[model samples]
Target: MTKDLLGRHRAVLPDWLALYYDEPLEITHGEGRHVWDADGNRYLDFFGGILTTMTAHALPEVTKAVSEQAGRIIHSSTLYLNRPMVELAERIAQLSGIPDARVFFTTSGTEANDTALLLATTYRRSNTILAMRNSYHGRSFSAVGITGNRGWSPTSLSPLQTLYVHGGVRTRGPYASLSDDEFIAACVEDLTDLLGHTRPPAALIAEPVQGVGGFTAPPDGLYAAFREVLHERGILWIADEVQTGWGRTGDHFWGWQAHGRSGPPDLLTFAKGIGNGMSIGGVVARAEIMNCLDANSISTFGGTQITMAAGLANLTYLLEHDLQGNARRVGGLLIERLRAVAAQVPAVREVRGRGLMIGIEVVRPGTDEADPQAASAVLEAAREGGLLIGKGGGHNTSALRIAPPLSLTVAEAEEGAAILERALRSIS
Candidate 1:
């Protein structure tokens, strides 16, 4: 059955739309943190569909909300007054921490970020953008233009002249050996020098944690230091929180809070988890910037009634249950467990991430060379052992991405870790 589906998928889908495993499993149903494939093989879902399932699989609250909203109305374009949209927007704005914030919804992170780019470019009247190296924002033209990861970025043509910035990955770079403070200074100096050679950029956009680049991140205060430089030059700061938002990072509600010395970003974009499997994405900014567009604009499907209801329910559940705190506690233990497992495996290079968004970089034993084969081997092995994880990185896709739902429990974490440990040992 799985083979038949794979054959049909290859026949119909774009080759670039990648699927996992030697034989990709069609996930038929899920409950809590576990999912069953069409063959009825139950696997612990650690990736949570790239971390979209923020709470739990088949969560009752989300299901109820979606069902009730569908019964009422599924969609009413931005043309109509959406009560759920407004409610979700109000909640998000308050949680966003932006002063005098305004919210605009989109169906995906790409659109949210595209909207952000539009706002920044129009407000600053600049076509230039600054993005972190090894970053993946979205697949849209404008989003891809600012993406610095060559593996993910398909084209060089862009409406915005994007300048790649340093300091997104602290472990590898010209300043990799520097102390945290020194690294921040070096990156700031590099940015300053880059600015000297180019026109004033509209905004410096970056992911607090590079998701597709293998959960890489800079030193904690690096962005805050850069914020000082950008602020002096009137350049906006846009935090791409698609993977790092809504308390996935443990200590911070938003990943930018890791660099909260400078307060909130001028613009913040988020998606993935807030809807708990529903498509919900948006940008939050001060009214001045969000209101910068002179002409009219509305997303045909953005903030549709169904998605908004889901967002409202999911956000409410996340906050009410303090899933952020759960992420902190459980994720901390999970990382520690994985680190121990990695220590015993020669091919495991490094385990890094905050809260639930962790990455284990695979490398050749006793060498810094990326080991993508080892990553693939481990991924396949884990699946055989009833665990579902993900792999990605800028360096030949050699890192295992382990972003589980924020509501992960301690016992489930241990179960998943044990399976992963066995998988790593099998590959090693």
Candidate 2:
């Protein structure tokens, strides 16, 4: 029977397609913060579908909206406007405070980033761009061009533009010695140097808080300084809120606001939390830059009626229930617990992040090098202990990332922390 199902599924998929996941666990269903695999084993989900499922799996309102939209009309080509699309854009703008900000919808976080980069490149009419070291943008030519990781390079290189690398902020260890002010100053200086070195560049793009880069938040004053420097150089600043946006961070509806900066970027990209999993991303731009476009950029699948409904409902649920507040309360508990765990365990290096976007760096005992194996052991042990977690950069496999659903409770967070503690102790 399993073989029959496999054969049937195989018929629907392309032979050239690849499976990118590891240690595959077949999932059945999820409710709130708990997911059960095919074997009926429940796992506490600390990894919220790569930080996309903000309100939790199969949220009532979000699913209901999607269902209603699907029953009505799932798609209306860009030649026409749909109500859900209109309402979603309006609500998002209202929440984001980007007055009259026009939106261009896409299919994924990477696609939104790619679109933002395109807009900046066209607006600035420049060939060079700057990105933070160790940042993960997207795999497209332009995105890969600006992404700072050399590991992304392969047989094919991007033809769109040249990339200039800048220093990402560091707040701990060798980077710890520098005060927040010092670190921000260094980033500003490095960006300024890069701007001069690559003059007339199109834009400087970065995550408000480095997401896959170990949930690292940039130093204070960094975004303001970048905006000032980039604007002075006639360059646009693009905020990639792929992982950090949509209330994953507490207090602010968008991660960009969590930076506590005043100036807004030329363009902003969001995807993960927007659709609640229905494949939607919104690109909101400063009105001036938005009006600069000559024609509408439409997609075959972007912002379909169903997608808009799901996203609008997801954002609504996040607001009505004040999930951001929950992210604050619950994420605070998780961070504090991890800090306590780190203090107790020698292998645990640091716990960093705000709200639900948390990372715990597990250090090797001998060389002080990042111990990815130890991190893997911890993740596996957490699974055995009935919790699910993810990892991030700092040594691809070394940094343990814990960004659970914003709806996760304080008690659940405590359980996750306890599981992490047990896992770390066993490894040590």
Top-lDDT candidate index: 1
lDDT of 2 by residue, 131-242 (tens): 7777777766777777765555432366455554444536443344777787777667766776665558888788877777777766656787778877776888788988
Model 2 clash pairs? none
TM per candidate comes to: 0.99, 0.92
lDDT (C-alpha, whole model) for all candidates: 0.93, 0.77
The candidate 1 region of ten consecutive residues with least summed lDDT is: 389-398
Top-TM-score candidate index = 1
**TM-score of decoy 1:** 0.99
RMSD of 1: 0.9
